[model samples]
Target: MYCYFDGQFMPISEVSISPMDHGFLYGVGFFETFRTYEGYIIDKELHEERMNRALKDVRISLDYSFDEVERWCRRLNEEEGGRDGYFRWNVYAGEEGIGMAADRYDHPHHLLLRKPLQRTERGTSKRGFILEHRRNTPESSMRHKSFNFLNNVKARQEVTSLATEEGILLNADGFVTEGVTSNIFWVKDCVVYTPSRETGLLEGTLRHRLLQLARQHYEVEVGCYEPSDLLNADEVWVTNAVQELVPLHEIDHVSFLGKEGPVYSDLHEQYTEYVKERVSEQC
Candidate 1:
């Protein structure tokens, strides 16, 4: 697929970054993965906020504006007949010598990647498992969707079924953190529960929106949680920008209502309408 790197658009195969880049040498980089509907990026402002927060936290600079970014994104979509696509924006500190610079990176490399969307039934359920690898603490004060993803990758390696299962990670304190690539939510006694940022999980864009929307119709709770608290729940679901929201039918032999859960059904419906409304406004 065609992608944008540096200042030019090229085939993804032709794009490359320097090995000496701090992002490679020191893991000084961040990214955002999202999807487009009708060629519109959903909740991009939220995504950008997350990106900007990471940039600020690590002293990485952005030389481009959102308008330019959106234009490039639209151009990439147009190249492929404008079908809905998965998009990833990668920003990294530019090449610096071997030693720790102890200086803010003024030049940053930016790359945009596009891939065809892989469709999954909206209400489909995925099994969940507790991973053996504990989630590492945030590199900075708070977690950003940064290139420091090896910890997540290592934990995901333990999943028995990648296609049908999601592996949840815990922190050193053994509190439920999140799924490999998604934020987790469970329902008990009509209340929705999810791990807070204090647990060191990258708060996904959709997860942020769900917290606000869920509050309008249901009592929502966010705090540190243990496996037993989640296991005792009646329903469970995971959220990410690409997948939106997915129900987990079982975790550790504990069965949930999955798509049939009343809370899941109502929230999914609400979330769907919310997307449609946002898409219409963009149109």
Candidate 2:
């Protein structure tokens, strides 16, 4: 695989970063992940918009233009000689600099890489999950896909290493937030329920579209949900741009009847159509 770093393209193995970089030292940076289909980026505008928003939040100066980033992505795609893959583009606090502090840094670096997209097994588990709250809060920087991921990483490790697929995160007040790396959604009486923006959920690219499309056929509620709400949910699912809509067979150990639920099927169908529309638009 090839990666673009600090204004140059290089093999992934050849790419390097300084230990002093804030992205590593202080976890100050922004990143976006998107997939390619038939050599075109999926939801390119949305990814860029989120990344730009991250930059805006931290008041970081971007030296490169949006067109430059797109150009680099296109070049890397061509060099990869493939039509479909995963792309993770990052802008990190650069090397040590004057007036450096943990609050912020200077001269952030840019890195973009392309890799093969791997799919997880779907339609396998018919059980739901049992979960323990991680006690995270929206004010704790949960929204940014920053280099700092210890919280989500640790929480995920607790679930994934046990052979379970995903876990739910909770806010400090015990309200359900999201999954390890994706947005959480559940179906109840033909309505879709997901964490609201106030819960500090990352406004995921697929998540936004999923909500929009779902509203066309069913009521989509973006609001706080507790474990009790999930317990009564007819069906539960999680979504990310990469994974799309995946049913949650179990939450912790409780089996959910999500496998054959009509609401899950509707959202899944809309999600598929959303992807198709975007890919078709690109073409």
Candidate 3:
């Protein structure tokens, strides 16, 4: 595999960073992950927009433009023979001597990495378990894809089964916030519902798209919801950039009626068509 470091493309094995870098020492960095289809990034603009907001929030100076980033992605994809894959763009404090102060870093370094994505079987449903750990609210409010991911890592470790797709994380208030890596949504009585951003969940790009798409055909509600709400839901779904949309068949002891419920099926079909259209536009 190859990755873009600084301003050059090199083998991932040869890439190295200073051990004293602020990103490594203090976890001061921001990143965005999205999928590419046939060399084109899905929702490139949306990702860029979110990245800009996150960088500003963390007081990281923006030195690169979205167009330049896109060009590099296209170049790397071509170099890799144009395979569909997942990509991560990371911007971190470049200062070698970091002492928990951002003022020391004059400029940040950006790295782009890609890895081939294995396609999953069609109609596959994800099984999740409500984790014992609750999301720490105040810090989670940032909602940026920062380098501090130990919380998510620990939550993911609780998923003992390989078949479990994700671990559902609740907020301190005992409200379902989101999955360890994706946003959570459920349907009850033909209404689609998901946790609001106030619940300390990241506003995922796919989650926003799905909400917009579903709103056209169903009443989409965003608010704090408890575990019982999900357990009694007629259908449950999780959304992220890579997995896209995954219907939930079971959560812990509560098993849903069907593998893919009617609401999920319709929205998934529409989402697929939407993706095709976007990819074609890039072509």
Candidate 4:
């Protein structure tokens, strides 16, 4: 695989970062991950909007624009025979010594990583289980998809140790927060439910777009919810850019509609068409 570091493209194995880099020293970095479709990046604006807000929160400045990102994507994909690929756009505060600097970061470092796209087919299902670790509060006002991922990493370890595909995390107040790496959603009595950002979740781009699509046909609710509310849902699913939307067969052996649920089927179809439409536009 090839990764663009700073200003050059090279093999991922050859790329390196200084130990004193603030991103590695004090976790002062943020990133976004998405997949390209026929060389076109979907939801680029949403991803950048989120990344910019996170960078601003920590006074870390990034100068990369969408045009630059697209060019990088095109080049990186061409490296793999022009195939669509998964990409990680990471920017961090350049070397700033050991201590936390009070001034804003002017010399930022960046890396554009490319990997094979991996996602399950629509209608496939995965199971979820609640994790013993409570969800950690955001370091700032909102959760930034940053390098500070120890909490999620540990939860992910537990999920693997427990042999579950999706691990659900709860706030200290016992409200359903979100999946370790994805936003959570459920359907009940034809109304769609998901935890609000107040629960300290990294509101995903797909979650936001799904809400818009669902609102056109079903009532939508966003708030702090309990596991019981989820276990009792008519349908359950999790969303991320990589996975798009995945049906939950069951959580804790309590089965819902899973992939066969009417809501999941309808919304999944809509989402599939949405992506195809974007690909068509690119063509």
For TM-score, the strongest prediction is 1
Q: Which candidate number maximizes lDDT?
A: 1
* TM-score result, candidate 2: 0.87
- Candidate lDDT scores, in order, read 0.90, 0.73, 0.83, 0.88
Which should have the higher TM-score, number 1 or number 3?
Answer: 1
Number of clashes in every candidate structure? 0, 14, 0, 0
For model 3 the local lDDT of residue 65 reads 75
- The residue-by-residue lDDT of candidate 1 on 1-283, one tens digit each, is 8999998999989988899999999888989998887877778889888899889887887867665677788889899997778989999899887976686899899999999989988888999988899999988888888888999889878987656899999999999999998999999999999999999999899998999889998999999999999999999999999998899999999999999999989988998999899989877
Which sections of candidate 1 miss by over 4 Å? none
Model 3 lDDT tens row, 4-57: 988999988988888777899988887888877776777778888888877777
* Model 4 Cα lDDT, one tens digit per residue, 1-283: 7889989999989988889999999889989988887888777778889999988898887777876897899899999999889989999788989899988998889999988986556777888998899898999988899999898998898776322389999999999999988999999999999999999889898988899888888899999898899999989999988778888899999998888999988998888888889778768
Candidate 3 is scored at a TM of 0.94
Please, what is the TM-score per model?
0.97, 0.87, 0.94, 0.96
* TM-score of model number 4: 0.96
What is candidate 2's lDDT per residue for 103-162, written digit by digit as tens? 544477889888877755654442334446463554345367777677777776667442
Model 3 deviation from the true structure expressed as Cα RMSD, one decimal place: 1.7
